[model samples]
Target: MPNTVASKRVHVAVGVIYNPHGQILIARRHDDAHQGGLWEFPGGKVESGETVCNALARELHEELGIVVHTSSCTQLLEIRHDYTDKVVLLDVWKVLEFDGEARGKEGQPLRWIKPKTLTKYAFPAANTAIIDAILKPRDSSFSSH
Candidate 1:
């Protein structure tokens, strides 16, 4: 039989986790990882045995040294982008609450930036949509965080 199964696309979950101060947490990719040195949200790829929410929680812990309850995060947006080696599908989340300080435990620099001011920083092209989403006004159901 000819090979008929399609290759599984690489998907990543990113969290636009922010605090009440209107500062969004962004992290620089480690020098060895893909798109290293570029500023992006704090998250990682979903592992084989974990759900997206679980992955997000784990990533936040690993990257930021913060423990976030999965229930506290909500899906904010999803994006797909094609790169030279692989296609990436990014599921972005908005984390309303978590525990512990967000340190760059992975040796990447972390910054808390105001959404309106994000455009001034250099980010991956795909991040433009994420920024736009952040800048849009929230609705009645929106939480301040």
Candidate 2:
């Protein structure tokens, strides 16, 4: 039998890493990987017993070479998406405070994009909410810059 959505809520943590100059970070998924050829926030799966914040920090350090203290992240948004083969619970965070420079440690193409221009990149269907959060966010903290 196939796994049910409720039984397979894969927890993934992502960071909307912003720089002091007001740019958002994004990375390109490998062409041969799932959801390939699209851009996405830097993140990875949340292992058992790990909090979302911990996962974010771990993923960012591993994927982007940035050091994010778990407490420095603000809860941004959480979305659950169901594809044909799996269901993913994306725990997104807004990280403005962190140490180290951002680099694509995973060899993926990385960019720091202005928030208003986030829509130009091709992203996965599940990323629509995240894009909305960046572009037309209900939260007043985000600026048109």
TM-score of 1: 0.85
lDDT of 1 at 132: 82
Over 31-131, each residue of candidate 2 has an lDDT whose tens digit, in order, gives 99998989999899999999899988988999888899777688778998887757889998988888998888878999999998898999998888998
The sequence of per-residue lDDT tens digits that candidate 1 reaches over residues 73-101 is 88878898876656789998888888999
Which portions of model 2 show Cα errors greater than 4 Å?
A: 1-6, 139-145
Deviation (Å) of 93 in candidate 2: 0.6
Off by over 4 Å in 1: 1-8, 137-145
Taking all chains together, the TM-score of candidate 2 against the true structure is: 0.90
For each candidate in the order shown, give its overall lDDT on alpha carbons: 0.84, 0.87
The local distance difference test score of model 2 is 0.87
Clashing residue pairs in candidate 2 are: none
